[model samples]
Target: MSGGVDSAVAAARAVEAGHDVVGVHLALNRMPGTLRTGSRGCCTIEDSNDAWRACDRLGIPFYVWDFSERFKADVVDDFVAEYSAGRTPNPCMRCNERIKFAALLEKALALGFDAVCTGHYAKVLRAADGSPELHRAADWAKDQSYVLGVLTAEQLEHCLFPLADTPSKAEVRAEAEHRGLSVAKKPDSHDICFISDGDTRGWLAEQIEMEPGDIVDETGAKVGEHAGANAFTVGQRKGLRLGRPAPDGKPRFVLEIRPKDATVVVGPEKLLAVEWIRGIRLSWAGLPPAGAEAGEEFACEAQVRAHGDPVPARARVEPAGGDPASGGTAGGDPADGGPAEGEPADGVPGPVLHLTLDAPLRGVAPGQTVVLYQGTRVLGQATIDAATALDRVG
Candidate 1:
């Protein structure tokens, strides 16, 4: 329950529905002993105790499961490896994919639980044929469906979200208060829980080797020097501290980060606009579109990040091949000639996505997830392999 009001209310709702609910708080941190600082926590002892207290009030059993090792291997290490490879990863998605649904849900099923219920702000409705269909939460402002996009069709069957019907976060909090839960007024966690201060670049530097590198312009002329290329993301603009401004005095954004070459490329903002997004490790949340075939175009709204605007696009499932899965340009493996920890073993990746955005979008980064949807229903998802600028496609 993460010791939060949302999950507490979710548990209450489940209990009200006559389900024998057991509240299990996952101990995701590997720290020997630590205390939660204020409301800035997910795995803190304070949160655990709150979860236990909530469970007690609901007359249900509460257990704290130690999943620290698995969380470190899957989410923490993967975050570092992805950054070192110059790809901007969504760690929350990875946590949902590899830990919550994959690991925790597997364990729950083994223990005879029908499904893994959480407080995620997303909906799962039954189709006419009885298969679960994932949809965005009714509260559009608090919809968390993007992070849950990594779940596969089979995984969706064993998942439940009680907050799916809740009108808003405020409503959940109010219900918690009405139910006499102490966490009703607790602040929500904002930063990445593992990163206490929210300085991602600073935290990463302490974990990964930071080698000094060159900051070059589009023409390959050195404009400045950076402590490390891995510290930069594809669209970052504020931290360059360049040696000189452009001749036209225009702002330049990060065009690319080449970790192998130890180079950070910066250029005009227009350089970031892209129309083509190719992806790997594609998965579907429900049954694939009927009679869908390779190269057959399907229209949908494509979302690149959590809370980002969904852009109009047409996508075609393409055969997985070539540089996207194996090369740096598409944000694949590192130059060390081996699969990065947490990545699929060296082989052909899963299906690839070839999406053409109706309008060019900017700041598209490799290794981010691309979720497809028709209206409010989720269609499928893909891990971004590469993005092609409109000008570069010719």
Candidate 2:
């Protein structure tokens, strides 16, 4: 449980369903704060107490598992590394992909547990052949399937989400109130949990060495300077402190960041339009779609952010043949050099998912994840290695 109303209610429902349920609150921080600072972050000591109270009320055992070291290695360090490489990453997705599902589920199964249930607002549907399929929840506004898109077929079988059928978050809160749960009115957590103060740039600055660098425009003319190129993000219009404005008197946004030489690129907003995306480190929530294993194109929807709109798109898997050491684009996964899992060892990249969007996605960046879907079912996800503008698509 997250010490939130959703998880509290989810545990109540699981007990009502007559299943033996145990409430587990992962202690992900090495030194968590004693109190929550409103809704800015999570996994604090206050959250753990709230989770314990909820489990007590439900007449079930509750335990706090210390996965702080693993969390730091997988999520915190990865976030810093991605930023240092001039790429934006979603730490929540990484947490779900590595810690919650992989580590926690593995431990649960080893202890003879049936499954690991959570408060995520997603559904697991069983096919006619009894295979599990991940789908969007009933409440679109609260759907979390995008972050859970990294789950493999084997992981989905050991997962359960009790909030799948809830109409809204309000309903979950109301149910918590009905159950007399103390966290019924607890505010939902936001921002990065590790950065409790909510100052991401400041937190990152402390972790990554910052060097002042030149900020340039599309014409290769220097417009201003930044204290640290790593602190800026794509589509960011604030904090540029550009001394010279555009000739047309229009504001420019961050178009790119070159960490190699600490160069920050700024341009008109139109330059942020992206029409193509090439992703690596591919992972599927279930079975590979038909023809996807054979390198044939298929129709699907792609979502870059957790709550971003799903765009109509076509995707295909194709061999990216080259020396793995020198083949990958900037922001590609470090493991991109090795042969993909479950693929033949031919000394090639095996495959990379290429997506063509029907409409332009603004400010799409490398190191971001793209979740694929067909209707409400999640097909898979990939970490973006590069994005191409319409004019550059040939």
Candidate 3:
């Protein structure tokens, strides 16, 4: 139940709908926080207690599943690996993809449960043919469909979201209060749950073997020196600590990270404009839209971040291994632009998607997920392998 108001209210609604419900709280850490600090982090011991109390009040059984080992391997380690390779990874997306839906749902179905219900603010509508379609929730401000975009058609078949049509998070809190749920007033968690202190750079420093590196401008001239290259991300501007100001007297932002030689590339903000993107490890929410299986370009909206606005774009999926002739762009690093390291050899089946934005998106980096949508329905998602700047295109 996540030990939160939304999940508590969702469980109540499920019970009210006359379905047998069990509250499952995932124990995703070997050493969980003992208390929550405002909204800084989640999955604390206190959260588990709150979940248990809510289940008790609802007269349902509650169980705590220890998936800490799996979480570390899939989400935490993946985050470290992505950063070490100079890519920004979304751990929440990984958690939702690997742990919550895949592992938890698998165990739930094995126990003879019809479905796994949650408080995610997304809808699963049945098409005319009775197939499930994933759509954004009525509460657009609180919609979590972006993170849940990794679900497959089969997974959506055994899933339920009770808070789909709720107008706002306020209504969910109100319902929780009405039900006397203890977590009705609990603050929502933010930042990465594993890093309780929220010092991402500091946490990563301990996990990755970072070294001092040169901070260079677009022309490959050193402007300054950084304590560690791993701590920087594209679009970051505050901590460059440049030894001199730009010749144009304008601010400089990180445009790329080259961990191979520990070089951080900085330039004027305009250099961050991304017009093209390539992604791998593609997965669809449900059935592929018409023509997607045939690698046809189609109009859709692409969303990079969880809460970022969707952008108008055209996207097409390529058969496994991608098109060899166009694997790299004019200004792409082999680590990002060309075939991903260890990718399947040519002619071997694998998944990849290419996208062109109607308008340039700023600071898009490799390792982020790009979710494709048509109107409010989620079409599919892929982990971005590369992003090409608008002006750098050949």
Q: Provide backbone clash counts, one per model.
A: 0, 0, 1
Q: What is the C-alpha lDDT of each candidate?
A: 0.82, 0.86, 0.86
- Candidate 3 has what TM-score? 0.93
Candidate 2's displacement at residue 331, Å, is: 12
Poorest 10 consecutive residues by lDDT, candidate 3:
339-348
* Candidate 2 residue 109 C-alpha distance from true site, Å: 0.7
**Candidate 2 residue pairs that clash:** none
- In the order shown, the candidates' Cα RMSDs to the true structure are 4.9, 4.7, 3.2
Candidate 2 lDDT tens digits, 1-394: 9899988888888899999999999999888765779998899999999999999999999999999999999999999988998989999999999999999999999999989899999999987788899999999999999999999999999988999999999988888888899998899999999998999999999999998999999889999998998998888998899999999999999998899899999999999999888777888888878888666789999999989999999997755543344454222332432222232211224467778899989999888999999999999998886776846543
Model 3 steric clash total:
1
lDDT of 3 at 251: 99
Candidate number with greatest TM-score: 3
Give lDDT tens digits, candidate 3, residues 1-394.
8998888999999999999999999999778756778898788898899999999999999999999999999999999988998889999999989999999999999999999999899999988889898999999999999999999999999989999999999888888888899888899999999998899999999999888989999999999998788898988998789997899999999998998899999999999989888777889898888888676779999999989999999887776645444453322224433333444212224567778899989989878899999999999898887787645643
Off by over 4 Å in 3: 323-349
| lDDT score, candidate 3, position 160 | 92
lDDT of candidate 1 at residue 122, scale 0 to 100:
95
Model 1 per-residue lDDT tens digits across residues 1-394: 8888888998999999888899999999877366666656568877888899999999999999889999999999998998888888888899999999999999999999999889999998888899888899989888999999888879999888899977889999889999999999998887778886678999999988988989999999889999988888989999999988997899999988888889999999989998878777888888766644444668899999889889999886644442442342222333412222323322336555668799888888877899988888887888776776645642
**Winner by lDDT between candidate 2 and candidate 1:** 2
